[model samples]
Target: MALNLTLKPFERIVVNGCMMRNGGRKTTLTIENRADIIRETDLLKPEAAATPVRAAYFLIQSALIYPDRRDALTKSAQQQLAKLATVFTPQLARHVFEAANNVSMGEYFTALRELRPLMKRELEVLGPAGLDPTSPDELPRIPT
Candidate 1:
């Protein structure tokens, strides 16, 4: 199967670990085979991974961008998912579990799709004053 992607001017995308930016005009990309592709808008920098869910997303993104480190990245993402599930409501936790399952099955992009909603929910629940970005230990913990 082939995938078609359209990029706006100056938009960037990473294909098989190679970063490419579209020229001044809109461009369409046709992925003819299986490849790791991620858009610039979806890219999350390590410094921006302040929330637990965002951190998990970063790990999954890394797995896709760096196949050589997929094992370690997947493991870390799974562990973080477990912790996040415990802290979130059961409904929201389903997203975390689904992402973990996808990661385990080598579907990094699918896993990222699952995590996106959870990331938004996390921000909605935490709000601005709720988190201390400088300290990760301050993240919400599971109730005993």
Candidate 2:
């Protein structure tokens, strides 16, 4: 006799340290901190909002990259996030890019690391970091 094994659509499977599963399934995990989410999504802001996002991005990125600077970096990121919230609408801002409540810190950090390159590229394209709401020159110059 032969037997067949079937898997549920949302069943969790762990292989080689990675979890595989379908979407829309809730888990018991809880993420108590919002910093991780902010760090990951801040990197994808458009050129216009790049300055503040860049500040937040580097602050968080440095924290992840250097243990000694973690506290300082976290503080800096918090400041930048506050500034960002004041300047842009919630829907248009990158400040809201946070991990879901169930996301783990390790997973959040890994995702941030993966997003670093794209963030760097966006910053380069944006140029001359530092938020200046009143400076018309801060606008990116496109080739004529």
How many clashes in candidate 1?
0
In the range 20-65, model 1's lDDT, one tens digit per residue, is 9999999988899998899999998765677888888888888888
**Ten contiguous residues with the weakest lDDT in model 1:** 135-144
| Best candidate (score: TM-score) | 1
Q: Quote the positional error of residue 5 for candidate 1 in Å.
A: 0.3
- The C-alpha TM-scores of every prediction are 0.87, 0.37
Collision count for each candidate, in order: 0, 3
What does candidate 2's lDDT look like per residue over 1-144, in tens digits? 222223344655432223456446544333344322232223332243336455455445545444555555555555655555555445434422341110124333543553345445545665654333435565322211
| Alpha-carbon shift of residue 126 in model 2 (angstroms) | 6.6
Task: Show model 2 residue runs off by greater than 4 Å.
Answer: 1-50, 97-144
